[model samples]
Target chain A: MEYETPLFFHVMRYAVRADRDVIDMVSGNPDWEPPEALREGLREYADLESSEFQYPPSDGLLELREEIAARRGVDRDQVVVTNGAGEANYLAMARALERDRGSEVLLTDPVYPYYPGKTTLLGGSQRFVAAGEDGQLDPERVREAASTDTSCLVVNTPNNPTGAVYPEETMRELVAVAEEYDAILLSDEVYDHYDLSGTFASALGVESENRIVTDSVSKTLAITGFRVGYAVFPHDLAEEAKSRHMLINVAGSRPAQYAVLDALRETDPAYHEANRELLAERVETFTGALEAAGAEYTRPDGAFYVMARFEGYPGTLENVEALIDDIGVAGMPGEAFGDSRSDWLRFALVTPRVEEAAERLAERFG
Target chain B: MEYETPLFFHVMRYAVRADRDVIDMVSGNPDWEPPEALREGLREYADLESSEFQYPPSDGLLELREEIAARRGVDRDQVVVTNGAGEANYLAMARALERDRGSEVLLTDPVYPYYPGKTTLLGGSQRFVAAGEDGQLDPERVREAASTDTSCLVVNTPNNPTGAVYPEETMRELVAVAEEYDAILLSDEVYDHYDLSGTFASALGVESENRIVTDSVSKTLAITGFRVGYAVFPHDLAEEAKSRHMLINVAGSRPAQYAVLDALRETDPAYHEANRELLAERVETFTGALEAAGAEYTRPDGAFYVMARFEGYPGTLENVEALIDDIGVAGMPGEAFGDSRSDWLRFALVTPRVEEAAERLAERFG
Candidate 1:
């Protein structure tokens, strides 16, 4: 398989060392304070006994997994803490493929590149079904695309690049399709807390053994550096995922998990509410600037990204670099995601300078 | 592949909540203080700016990589920091299989179970070459066992379950066999710091493009929960490994890496030397007790594990549990390693109560 490294880091690196100033809308690293509790937790961890510095339970610290399970309405046995949602997704996909129902992974076009990338890495064939223009996947289209050969279906809600939160009905229908095709529905809800529309539905709510949900506090808790995430599998599949996780990572960072657990317990709902409000405002400002530039764009309903199209400029790597060099604005080339969005540029509004980047884009493209 | 979960955790968990005071020789968790500098680093991290808590460079923190490169005598670009030595070894194995030389992996019998577990996880076939009774691999046997079908040779110096530090000449011959067979040589030298014998040889010392060495401070620093480790690849293989690392895990825990980097720079060699001395003392004491029990045991030349065969007691799941229940001591069943040593049991002498556990075993089995 070709090693198609994700381009987020590549573009971010280019923007970083560029001679001119570049507003980084390229990567998803959050530009906000993590929960105060998280820092406090880390400080507390430093004083932990020597044995506490050894490995946590291979699945995770039992307390954290129990907390995650309690919140997600699952048993603790169903949760396997992972390095991040990246590994969570990888484990979910591996479990799906390992079921031997099929070797083809069904993904959406204009997908999170890592989804297709991981499928290929795990030696599974990929089949893409394009999402609608507003970035919502149609269950009918997915059903049509899937067959007995479809081992898994990967969907990211409050999705990346194109932030569409699937409705509860869509999630149910997707689960039905997965059930009918004997395929696992792997839902990545890492952007769960970024649901500006409040219409986001979790696969965990779907009553199907065929569904697995992967999530992380990376975005929610604003602790991407902590590298803590988890997957909720059906009880039967949990053992294999845990085994895979143990073999792959042994365990997540105990300090990170401890911190995340403390944050989860101590941080108020207002913390999440405030971040959502902040992202909601950024979306309004950024999309309004796109309107000023007379560029076509999809204003995100969820997550912290906006996809825009300029009149004559296609979102190629060359165009992305040109914008970085010329306009001092950096965004991901949509073609890097998949062919469907080849003419669009996706910007992560994760920086405090989102408005400034929007102004830069409007002034130049306008 | 039947999800053969590594038995270490299963046995450890059994002992943890067992009805008695079981001495935990089952797991390799070191019972020692991590460097004071590491705790200081975590406290320092809690005070860093918010952006500093964001995702680190996918490969690793630059200073950490540079520090590792300088110490290991490899180019900075040749190193990829991983979740732990576990992920480092995973990445190396993935790269070797991706090279498509062959799908078969050559491993040592009486092996670290994770090596074969990883081989199966990666969809590769495994072939084992038995080690000598002293728990050391004969390079001639390795060369005789390897074929063009073998894509990689995974060896651990100061190895797990059996502490066999490869001599410089043995490492040279293993590299030669890998080079001759067009196989990648993946040497896991995680126990480099615990080399009780002065003759421990690193694959990095061999100038072969086929060589990849994986190491971590989990044992040396007694901070397994930090989950920071790295792999040094041949310059040509670095990119693919990095890409795989990124996809499998977006990044390692930034705080853990930051803290580890601090400890690496600030902690004196005395910390490591002191640890080695402690383990050497534990080995002498534990083995002496084993001798009193009239058991045939391999005295480790390096690493912390001791394998012993008790007369009339074949190492098996039931026997391991019986030993734990009756004698209140825990050790891994040798059959968990491979058929080559099914009659033996492996004990990790990493706890303060090693002497007590050793006494219990001697009294019961003698």
Candidate 2:
């Protein structure tokens, strides 16, 4: 019941410490400036009165929660500001299992690794339903995999590793599946702002008491280290989630939340659009190189990752290491995601060296 | 079972939103200036390069952990920088419970309410052992209350409600009891810096594999909102705790850690000494008023709280509310802690209004 693999940071650290020149495509930390107002907020916080440095409300700062609620079109009481989307998902999943409906958690194959790790940590059994090759999860497939014993079905849109944006109909059917099974639909939309398809739909859009949409300013504002994120829960679940959040971390960093609130209030939407365009360009460059290398790859619809499969190069720890040592480019081994994507490698196109890493992969694999 | 009482914030908020001129003695937030270097660190962080805003090492910033390790005399690997001592305690308790030895968690009565709340959240059954009237836990009492079925024993010192600082002999015997039961001892020493008594000892000094020390900069630096804390574990427990922390929170706030680390390195011991001296004065003033009022009370050995029992005025929610409404003062109801201290009210002396609050109580009750 332990995590089957070391976390992404392990591989990332190895790549980072390698003596050879390595272009990191392994980590998801965005290589872009955060909203200017975030830094401005930090500077301003330094001058605040001493009491301001004391604990914020255990749930979160009222203004930050209010902002998140307003932006997501949910009641302020429904939002539980978490340490990050990491804790948001954790709380959502924990609450789901706490309901006594079921202990079985439904996840996607080629999934975000943290989901399963969290399931094990929370003492829930995990069952993975494989998504299609295009990283698309068929609602029927999920429905078939779930049961009354399934406590929750977790999905990420504008997703990680595969970067598939679930469409409105798919989201609706998924919600229906959850409703039918009496399971919570825990939707992680941390990458919502990075949608390139212009069709990303939130589980929030599909109204249901069972839906919990978890998001963070980490990706949108390029401040993962800030650790300010929240979950929008059904009213029944919000109080418990906030209480759990309080017991877990007391609350997130107040200065971080303050900075994020300031940034949220002042930053223009154009800033997000500009970052999306930058990712779009990087995606094109990286995928074109995959094509030139004659490798099959998923052209991501959103987020900034591309999964590529090279012939005779089944993704494995050895191969991942060889790529790092020999070609000087680092990517996550597909096997790390789950068995379904075991033959592919996932590259995060978040670094400025995306084009350079693409060229290295093209030359080596071709 | 659910938490028996609402969290401290609920009461704090009630007092905050109260229309009366209540002198707040309920919340433990320190009313003092944090080291100036902390603010300087935040200002400097606002200008750091973009990559610095990405995730620090998931456990924590290496520099911060290293600083903590050096100061605490533990190996760097033994430290897992957490969201606060809150999460540090959570991970330590979780790891102890996960050992599969038992599910019963031993806690002190008149406990910090959050301890029992956390035990419940973690799905462990809780058993409370009452301390002496003076707020001192007799190790023999804890040994008598515990069994082989106990997974962990949690203690806070310089305690929250009672403010008892365990002497070395007590801590050593407590460690022995934990060893005998094959249970982990989770020590929350967030108030270590607030210790006014020269005799205050850390469980870390007791030296047992069963011991895990949880601490935070929140109380020490008077920056609870910074949310930077850590756990020091035996080597065997460190990796799993770090992994759990990563899943719970990708990492704590980098800027917060940076600021704390700066303050840790730059702030003089005299600053802490000054704060302690200030608290010592406040404690004397508050206790004199309690004596004048002819109320029974515990003179705290360390930390900044006083538990007082007024004649014909048992600590209850209604009584606490009446205090806020009629006497224009707020102190936490003793019933909120546990069964043993139900007749007493706990006042946090960490406020500038201690003199005013003391006068109000003396005039009304004397």
Candidate 3:
């Protein structure tokens, strides 16, 4: 029942609370504020006494669904609002498993930890396909992992920990594989807006029935705590997904939904541009420090994270604690993610004072 | 998959929209604005920077937890914030089932329909014990329902559909049943503040180890759509419950949480007193109209609902729809609640125009 992210974060908080100069490079939080327009929308929505404060339609508010449809280029009926992408992913898996018992969920090795965690929690078996050394998921590996028992496959693009964005061709091939196996594809596109390569891809763009897209305003709007997210499914499965979502968590927050709807309608393009620039700059600064420290790491094309391998530092629980205690920084061990190599560690470059954090790391490891 | 309440209310809305004169006695919504102090507190909290929108501590905001603990007279570690009382009840049952596979969930007959729906969805078995003809649950009947296979028992005092509040002796007997069977007591006390009989009771006040209380500000503050609720559990199960709650929905809304905290701290006593008085008056007016119409019904002791039985008219789907279509009044048929021989219908006196509604009903039924 314990969540690894919060548990690790709590440990780090306790480790550094007394130290004023401690740097937090552990959480995958975006160190930016939502656009001014979004904030104003929240203010306006909060002022009005309307049905927004009452129980919303079980599916979702229409305007929010329309906005998602407009942005994702899908029919409004294809989408369902969820608590967050996490819950959406969980619902998709649960629905798929319920529809076909004794089914397995396929995951890419070094996947976003939640995928496997949710799979286990839902009483489904998981099969992992190793990503190449470049941290990219190859279509052939996925095809090899697919089986008649595989009912669902979770794919996170511009992925967490690795930051590998699947190319259009790769996604098309993967969709073909899912079609061949008759499996549901659960695409976690929560980090869609953070594609630094300027080449974002979505499985929903493909013409296929075996796809469910999960995304949230957390990363895009810098409002993770608001917990407003959604899933897009084929018309045939949308009802089941919606039902499971409601049964699991009655509905998302009333005010937060209004705020998210406002954020989407009013936020300017320049706000996203500014956020992208800030994140790109921080990623460069931190990766440069990692290089100066003689660390081997994958420079992410997107997201505010990079996985680095330090000499003689096998990613273990003991080493993780040492890094926090001795270096005054916190990062996730790759071992916690999957059955992959144990020499890598995940660092989040989401601190506002990126330059200072880089300097501190350089002083300790350079 | 579809929720009966929302669907029923939607049909009621369609009828209301078709004719503005139609009286809505179907929705369990409260008819009062949030306390002014709470609204102001929300405005103040909303003005804070977007950092407050970041991912919440998986458990919940510590301030809200402390407030709930102080109010419930429980230890701070015993409280967990959930999406709503619905989600709290859902998660509590899920946790119990996880602890004991294929657990049986015992519910009072004519109980809140959500309990049975959620339990069935969670893959748990449900057993029902009939409450007395007075619309009150009998302790001996509940004791008889408890068995070795019973993993959890759900009790809603100040109950829904039927406004029967469990007295102290009845609650004590139920607690003994739970303790004897080693089963968890899942108490839904969302309507705790709406007690018109001046007999406010809580399972937490009874000092039971096998009890969890689910309550929300929705009813008290008249913000049913805000979707903010909490569950207070014994210390032994607090961590598991907190983790499962967060895993399911992450956390409740930031602004809503801050608003409830402010409401709990600053809302004047007179505001609540006035609300109670208004509801009490409506109950009296509506009951008088029903009596004049020659309907047989039990007087509500608490909550904003009254269940009435009509002579020569068994409560059926046809009758409920006829009342809406011809009589221009909407109510829930008793069949949806449980299998009972009594021909009854439920009316929610939560609207401001209850007097006019009563007059409209009297015109048709009398």
List candidate 2 segments past 4 Å from native.
A4-6
Which candidate do you rate higher for DockQ, 1 or 2? Answer: 1
> Weakest 10 consecutive residues, lDDT, candidate 1 chain A?
A1-10
Candidate 2 lDDT tens digits, B273-333: 9999999999899999989889898888888799999999998888888888888889999
Error of 2 at A21 (Å): 1.1
Candidate 1's docking class is high
DockQ of 3: 0.56
Best by DockQ: 1
TM-score for model 2? 0.98
- How close to the true structure is residue A37 of candidate 1, measured as C-alpha lDDT? 96
Accuracy of chain B in candidate 1 (TM-score): 0.99
| Candidate 3 residue-wise lDDT, B1-366, digit = tens | 343332354456566665446677776777577777666766776678766767766666888889888888988888888887878888788777776733899988887777887887877889999988877888788888778888898999898877888888777777788888878888889888888888767887778888888898888787887778888887877777766665556667677787778888887878788888998898889889988988877687888888888777776667877777776778777777888734888888877778887787788778
Candidate 3 lDDT over A323-359, as tens digits, reads 7777667777778777685788787877787777667
Candidate closer to the true structure by lDDT (higher is better), 1 or 2 = 1
As for lDDT, the candidate ahead, 1 or 3, is 1
Task: Please give the lDDT score at residue A186 for candidate 2.
Answer: 96
Per-residue lDDT tens digits of candidate 1, residues A1-366?
Answer: 576788888788889988998888887888888989999999999999989998998899999999999999999999999998999999999999999999999999889999988998888999999999999999999999999999999999989979999999999999999999889999999999999998999988889999999999999999888899999999989988888888888888888998899999999999999999999999899999999999999989898899999999999999999999998999999999899999999999888888889889888899
Q: How much lDDT does candidate 2 score?
A: 0.90
lDDT of 2 by residue, A4-107 (tens): 43458878988988989998888788999999999999999999999999989888899999999999999999998898999999999999999989999999
Q: Per-prediction count of colliding residue pairs?
A: 0, 0, 3
